[model samples]
Target: MLIHLAYTLTGDRRCAELQRMDSERLDMSGYAYYENIWGGGAESMFRRKASVVQHLDRLRVGEHSLFEIDDFIVNGGEGPGQQDEHRRLFAPAVDLNFRRFEQDRRAYLEGGAERQADEEAALMRWLPHCRRKLFFEWNAPELVNRLIPFLYLDTYLSLLRAERSTIEQVRRDLVLGLNRAFSHLYLTDSDNLYVTTQYLHSAEQPRPLVRLTIPLSGVDLFVDGRPDMAYDRERPDLLLRFAPPPALALRPGAPMPKLERWRLNLLTFEYLMRLAHGGTYNILADECELSVRALKDQLLSAFAYEPAEAGLIEFFVAERRRYVLKKIQIDEQGHLRSGG
Candidate 1:
């Protein structure tokens, strides 16, 4: 029935009787869930509108730009049964209706309805599917961030193969976008979580080595009823402290032998220095004779001595480029010079 109506509408059918019936049905049943969710009253409508507006503003976009009708309906999380009924009853003719509406808006300005009619015709031919509904409803920033990578993975891979951009740069951008979106939606009260990359090339493909750093003040980590030691805000050293379980004895000095500790510290220092100079993890692992897993475990454990403080140290170091770049200037001859 919907397909038939869509075909008719797209073909510019002048069936007033059919149009009136479809419009009435849509008004009565298709939007019933929206009314129910907003509570079929004036007050509820206002509240729903306000909530939507607030969410839109937080997304840093205008209301219409933030979401389409499909996004609104799908994110509402109505039951599957209701959705199926709606699709079966009215969805066939209204496939991509929101997109068509946008076209119609443009047509109204350009003095032509041809594009709008074409879109409506295309929608009619394309059967509305559950996946479309899913896309519409999952509108949260965090959700979009998480899904965008997967959605664009094929395009990204294609671009990588074409050598349009370096893999490392692409991975860095992906991590930054993911972290920014996550922070915006879930960590609203917390500062941005900076992501640093350590890229490693495998036999088959390259992988991103990711490090997440959140501000010490933004996180609360407690062990054995004691607050974790704070890191020096100005330093690059991360201090991580963890309480030993009752079964493990607490030692004041280093956990490993002195020789081993010294070796590990040297390795760690070299790795940190290389990372500061924009070195890749592949280079570090090769130089230090450490497996990726081993390096990550040791680095994470090293900070456990004073987790909170260490976190801040790492945070500052991770963001060092922002401040450090300004201090280093190049002469016309491309000689590097440092300012006091």
Candidate 2:
């Protein structure tokens, strides 16, 4: 269905052909639905609160539970016509809680270099490959953007676990103790709800200017529903946010809006890391089919760094390391740093 939708949207023949050939090339039953690895049984911290993360495709309307698709469709919502399924697609919005990282927050804020390193190290323990460049850089290439939601989720999950929330609460609410490969769990009500966090520049100061954005694709609620002959695509892509929980008052004043870098919209940072490690620049430029100068421009654009600003990062990707990209980190002084 998604492949067909992609084809419909992009009018890409390749997407259409892939949908047509799906049965022959892919195992639908084994992979059609992602397992509820990030959720506990019903009664978790979310809307249902069943004490576990449940993955059944059931909906509860007040006291009555609706499971069958036809029945759900038959029931009418506040909207005219058969909009039960549409209305069932969402629920009341709720605020997300993440006020659990204050100690580490203070460490990162009050402590100096060692504290910053310790904080980052703690975060890495949860999602090791979470590259730092994504947050610090201006913007990202498209592929990287797709992973931003998952990465940010991990950042918070790390904090939640580090704070030692209850085993069950962490298991269910924080989405731990599960075989989840990715980090988001979409619920019927999740579309209406968004995650938010707050921090202080100091104990009394609110860090309001640093707008931490969850780079998300546009969402359009289809009132008319699509031609699938059943119902509408209900869920929105998972949206999330992670605060550096940095101090507000000391933050530098910048009149110009800064570009964000947490999405997959940038080139592989590993390319530059490779270059930095002594790979030939001209040779790599040739392999990627661009002149050294043109490649350099793209590289500069990827890093959002210019040598004059000391943000410029130079690198070399050895032949064997072509696909390897490194993570980008920002130091307290805003200098770019890379490791692991």
**Reference-based lDDT, each prediction:** 0.34, 0.27
Worst 10 residues of 2 by lDDT: 175-184
- Cα deviation at 63, candidate 1, in Å, is 5.8
What are the runs in model 2 whose C-alpha is more than 4 Å off?
1-98, 125-145, 148-226, 230-340
lDDT of 1 by residue, 1-340 (tens): 3432333233322468447856775422222222222222344333344444333223221122224333433332357865564454333234334344334333444544656676445433322232223334533444333322223434333332444344334333323333322222111112322333444455744334324443423222211122334532332222122223211223455463111011222243334334433444544354453432353354334433432212122211123233211133345576656532
The TM-score values for the models, in the order shown, are 0.22, 0.16
Q: How accurate is candidate 1 locally (lDDT)?
A: 0.34
The true-versus-predicted C-alpha distance at residue 256 of model 1, in Å, is 10
Residue 187, model 1: lDDT of 18
